[model samples]
Structure formats: C-alpha cells, structure tokens
Target: MTVLSVDDIRSRVDADFDRILDVLSKKIALASISAHGITGEHMKRSAEFVAAELAKVGIDAQVVQSHNPDGTPGAWEVIGSHIVDPNAPTVLLYAHHDVQPVPDKAAWDTDPFVATTIGDRLYGRGSADDGGGIAIHCGALHALGDALSVNIKVFIEGEEEMGSASFIPFIESHRDDFDSDVIIVADSGNWSAQIPSLTTSLRGNTGVDVTVRSLTHPVHSGQYGGPILDSNTLAAMLISSLYDENGDLAVPGIAADEPVGGLQQDVDEAGVRADAGVVDGYELAGTGSLAARLWTKPSLTVIGFDAHPVDGSFNVISPETRFRLSLRTAPSQRPEEAQAALADFLRARAPFGAEVEVEPTDNGMGWAMDPNAEATRDALEAMREAFGVEPINQGQGGSIPFIPELQRIFPSAQVLVTGPEDPKANAHSPNESISLYGLKHNIITEALLLAKLGK
Candidate 1:
C-alpha cells in the first residue's frame, strides 16, 4: 500500500466532506438525548445508526449495552472494528451519540434537531460536540479507502451527556475489544474556528445539595415577613458566598492557576463574551488569563434550586429551600477533596445561622495528559501538516469522568483528545454548530495520522 502525503489527504478529505456533511446532518436530526429515567429507544436508534454507518466503511459493527452499578440497563453504545493487519497498531476513535436536552425551544433561531447550514457552520444539536467527531472517524476511514495500515475501532458512546455511569462496566465486559494502542477522544473543542488544539487537561467536578430551613411550615409573607427571612432568601445568601469580589470562585482549598508551559495562551475577551452570549453590560467573572480561568479554575454555580414556583404562587415565607451546586474543580485537584471542601464551606457559612444540611451528590476525577509522548508529537505534527498552522495545546473546562477511567483501564494506550468544537461551537446550548473548515481540517489530520500509523 502506498502512503499518502498530508496535502493529498487534505485534498481528498476536502473533496469528500459534502457526503460527510450529509452523514452528520442526518445523525444530528435524531434527538438522542440520554438522561436518567428516559426510554432508551432513541439511544438504541442512535447506536444502530452509528453501527450502520461504520458498516458502510467495511467495519463490522454492533449495538451493545451493559448494566449500571445498580443493575439498571445502560444506554446503547456502538462498537465497531475494521482490521487490515493484525501486526499494526490499533487506534480507537471515540465519540458520543448522546446530546444535552434542548432546555428552551423558543430560544433557538432554527430547529435544534434540523441540520441547517448557515454560512459555513452546520447548525444543530450535537453537530460539533460529537456528531462532527463521528463524521471525522467515518470520513477519514472513507477517504483512506483500501490504503489502510492500522486496525481501526470506533466507540460511539450513548450516555456521555448523562455522565457515562456505565462506561466502566461496559469496558470491563468488553475489555479486549476496547484495548488499543492509541485512543483519540473527539469530544473536546479547538482553540478557535481557525486554530486547531489538542486538549491536554480537563477540570474535575462534583455536585452538592444544600438544604436550608427557615421554618417548619409555610407562613403568609404579609403577616410574617417583618422579622424572619425566607429559606429561599437564605439560600441566595449562601450561594453568594461562593464567589469573591473579583468574581473568582471563593471556595477554599481549590485555586485556579496558569496552564503549564506548553499550553499557556490567552483568549480574546470579546470573542469569549460573544460565545458565552453575555447580555449587554455584563463582564466575565474571575481573574487572570482567560484560558487559565476557564481551563484550570474552580467554579461554583447554583445549577438547580427548589423554591416557590413563580407562576401560581401566593405570598408566603417558604419553610424550606434546597439548591444544587455544580462545582468545577481545578484540573490538578482531586474531586473528592473538592467535594469535601465544598460541603464544609456550605456547612460553616449558613447565612444568619439557618439550619443547613449538605450532601455530596456526585463526583468525577480530572485528568492531565503528558505533552512529551511520542504519539502526542505525532498527532501534533499531523495537525500542523494538515492545517498548515501550529496547533495549540489546550485544556477543556468540561468534565468527562469516563476519560480517567479509560486511562486506568488501558494504562499503556496513549490518549489524544482532539475535536472540532470551538468557542463559537455553542455546544450543549442552543444555536450549536461546527465550523466547516475546522471539520475538514480534523478529517484530513486524522486520515493523515491513520495513514502514518498504518505504515
């Protein structure tokens, strides 16, 4: 088999992307939102869809599932493989088929499930997060055709949006199938639409639920509002204490710092504001380089609150209130420690001595990858050659607990996290999209890497 140049691979991928776009669009149309207590039918269909696509590239594929720790069945996952030579290195291409729920339908300018191409972006849910990733794997395999050298396997997860609780079980059940020499996790984002990035770090996370009680039972606000504060008001006070005057997370024992030597870089402030959709006259929270604040900071957010509903409410001093806090820890900190510190912080700072009870709801470890590995250099070189620009070593602010577990399970395999998501990708939010040029570059780079590995 003849090895192809990066330019040759780029030209082939650029020419072949029209078909790949159709593939991604169709996948995006299926609202495969994996969550707790939902029917797994959509997940099953999504897994089947991925399997069928893998089969089109000469990969023998199947839809598989496993049991969670509590014995509940897990969401469907698509696993497939195409073996050209048993002696060559095996590369596992990873992506997820699940997407976050569309919280508000009216907020969207276009249908979230319909892949509408506006300008150069393919607008739809899951288009950038993992659908583009799926396309990259499929498109690269399609572009390479019969010139394959390394064996390829695809792991399309179905429960990533819901925290992949069953990933360990699935891998334990199918250890041999998952064992590979290299793993490319394509669920991360690039530095920008025009710049490629290798995700080198991810912040760990945990959730804590704090319940504050002001009274034993409800009371009329008009009659009892003078001296006593409502539980909801008390909850607000507790939440406010999590941040400092500079808007940095004020939690103790968790501190934000700069990304290590090779990954240090600053992001455009205006671009970040626009991507985050900050309303007029709002400034970003936190201090220091934008990348450091985002990639390595500890962030505290009041994700869910149990208070009086605004719709049909009567004037009343609520007796009790509950809120869930999502704590994103620093990249190098242990989540268990973060969880402990958060619980302690809440317990100690009960505003006005409101009876507060804190419980640790969930936790997942963070991860940092080595920048000096041979496979890392190879992937970076492949990106530079394909995109004709220096690639950035970046870090993601999101958490993929399954990633650390994957490394623990396959300690010898080099994990390379790269993807098509950019700041403007708007992943997990309305108006989500992927840049066409970025998508094309990734497909070409992966094809080049596979070709190099195949040799």
Candidate 2:
C-alpha cells in the first residue's frame, strides 16, 4: 500500500477544501436538533445525509437507530466502513451530526442555518461543534484517496447534543461494528486559531436536585414577610454555601487540590476571560491557575431552577423550591462519590432546617488520555507537521460522557481527540462557527496520522 506524502496530502486537501465546506454547509442547513419537542424526521434526514456523503467518498455507510433507555427507538447513528486491508490498523472516526437548537434567532448576526463566512470563521449552528468533525473525516478520506491504507470506520452520532442518552445501549448492541485500533474523536476545540492542541482530560459531571421546603402551601408575602422567609430565598442560601469568598467551590469531600493529569501547557488568564466572554470589573475565581480551576478542580453551577416567573405577579411565597446543581468533578474523580458528597452537604446545610432534600440526577465519569501513548506521539507529530508549530496539551472542563464508554468497550484501542473548534467558535451559542484555518489543518493532521497508522 502507498502512503500520501505530507506535501501531497496538503495539496489534495487544499484542492478539495471547497467541496468539504460545501458538504458542511448542507449539513448545517439540516437543523437536526436532537432535543425534546424536535421531530425525529429531521434526525433521519441528517443521518441519511451523513451516510450519503460518506458513500460519495467511497465508504460503505448505513444508518441505524439505537434503543433509548426505555427500550424505545432513539436517534439515528451513521456507521461507514472502508476496509483497505484486513491486516492494517483500523481507525474509527467519531463525530456527530446533531446540533443544538437555536434559542434566540435575533441574537445571531447571520442565519443560524446558513453557513456564513466572515474573516477566518464559517458560522452556523453545528459548524464547529460536530459538523466540522464530520467534515474532517470526510475531507481526510477524500484527500488520502487510494493512499489511505488503513481500514476506516466513520461513526457519526445523532444525539450527542442531547446528552447521548442511548450511547451505552447503542454501543453495546453494535460493539463488533465499532472495534478498531485507533479512535479519533473530533468533537473538541483547539487551543486557538494559530495553536493546535489535543484534549488530554475532561472533568466528570453530576447533578443534584436540591429542594427546600418552607411552607406546605403558598402564602402571601405581605402576611409572611416579617416572620418567615420563602423557600426560594432558602434555596439561594444553600446555593451560596457551595461557594467561598473567592468564588471557589467550598465543597468539603470533593475537589482535590491538584489536577491529576497535568498538561504540558496552561491557559493564559486573559485568554480565558476573553474566550469566556467575562464581563469587565470582575475578578477570576478559585485559588489556582486557570487550568487547574477549569480542568481539575470541582466546579458547581445552578443549571436549572423551578420557581415563579417575575413576569407574573408573585406576591405569594412558594412552599417549596427545587433547583438542579451541575457539579463538575476533577478529571480523576468518580462522579458517584461527588454526587454523594454534594447530596450530603446540601442535606446538612438546609438553612435553618428548612426540610431540604437532595436527589442525584444524570452523571458521567471524567476522562484522561494517555499522554505517552503511541497514538498520542503520532498525533503530536502530525499536528506539528501540519500546523508548523508545537501543539499544546490541554484539558477540557466539560465532560463527553460517551468517550469513556467508547474506551471501556474498546480498551485496547488508543483514542486521539482533535477538532476544528477554536476559542472563538462559540459552539451552541447564537453565532457558533469554526475557524477555516483550523479546519484545514485538522484535516491534514488526521490524514498524516492515518498515513502513519497505516505503516
């Protein structure tokens, strides 16, 4: 089997870049929102679109539906296999076609479904999140062509943006189809537009629903204002207990002092603030480097709260308030332990014995890639060669729950995480996008790695 030279790979990718973006644009127009209230017809169309695109590039692809938690049908998942040789290393390319819903259309500068290019970015709903991921696999395959010697399997999910509810069940059902030597998950972000990086670790996550009960029924605030407080205020106090003076997580049993898997580089404070869109006149939180606070230490956020809306007249004090707490555990910590500790803490600090109850919600384990693995070395070399700069090692504060499941099912397969989303991608937001430069380089890097694995 022949391998594509680096120069040849770059030339091929450059020539077909437009075609790649064209496919991405079509996908972005699909609006395959996998959340509740969305029709499954669009998901089917998205999966078929992905399959057709992969098939156009010479891969034998098909769409399959996985079973949801209740044994009901779930979203469509695309699986394409191109077997170059039985003996060569088989690589599984993972991405998703589902996108987040556009909540505020007025906030977007351009149509959320239209692929609008401005400056260095191509903006749309799923442009960077996973649409670019699918584009990467397709572009690499197209560029490599006959020179791609390794067996290739493109696995594009349809429910990634919706918490991947059927991930475990789907994988278990199709375990044999997903077996591979190397798995590349192109669903994370690069360090920046000019610097490429691989995500080495991701924080684990769990949620606790804390309910504070003050009265059996609603009471007029005018009548109860002097003597008793509302459950909403009590819930606020319980939430405040999770943070300290410096705004760091004050949980006792969770949040280890240090990041378990250290990175070769750390993020700049200014860069973090800028990327996160932090407001002015605000100080950074926690007592460690920005990387530690983001990637390793436990963080708490009030994700969902049930209360009376201010739009309506709400003079009555609601009897009970329930709010969902999303707790991000360190990369090395178990979510089960974190959930237990958080529940205990909330139950203990009930704000003057307001009859508090904490119930655990959805949870996922953290992940740390083997930095010294052979695949890791190959990826670094590929990034260096493609980007003409040393790659940065970074950790993600968010959790990809299914990644651990993939590793668990394919324990012998080495996983490599790469993507086209830069800090400015703003994925899941109004003006989400992908850097055109990063997309090209990531395609090249994957092509180079594939060539290397084929050897």
TM-score winner: 2
Put down candidate 2 lDDT per residue, 370-446, tens digits, no spaces. Answer: 88888888998999999999888788888998988888888999988888788889898889999999999999999
TM-score of each: 0.89, 0.92
Candidate 2 error regions (>4 Å): 36-39, 215-230, 257-261, 307-319
User: Whole-model lDDT, candidate 1?
Assistant: 0.85
- RMSD versus native structure for model 2: 2.4
Off by over 4 Å in 1: 35-42, 101-114, 214-230, 255-257, 260-263, 309-319
For candidate 1, write residues 1-455 as lDDT tens digits: 86777767777887888889999999998888886332378888888999998899878999988678788887798888988888999999999988888989898989999999999899999999889999999999988888878898888988888777888988998987899999999889787787788898888898898899989999999999978899998998988898889998887877565674354467778877876678999888878888888777888888999976799999999989998989888877888888998888889999888899998887888887878877788888888887888887788787888888888899999888998798788888889999998999889888888877665
CA lDDT of each candidate? 0.85, 0.88
How many steric overlaps are in each model, in order? 2, 0
TM-score of candidate 1 against the unseen true structure:
0.89
Each prediction's RMSD over C-alphas, in Å, is 2.9, 2.4
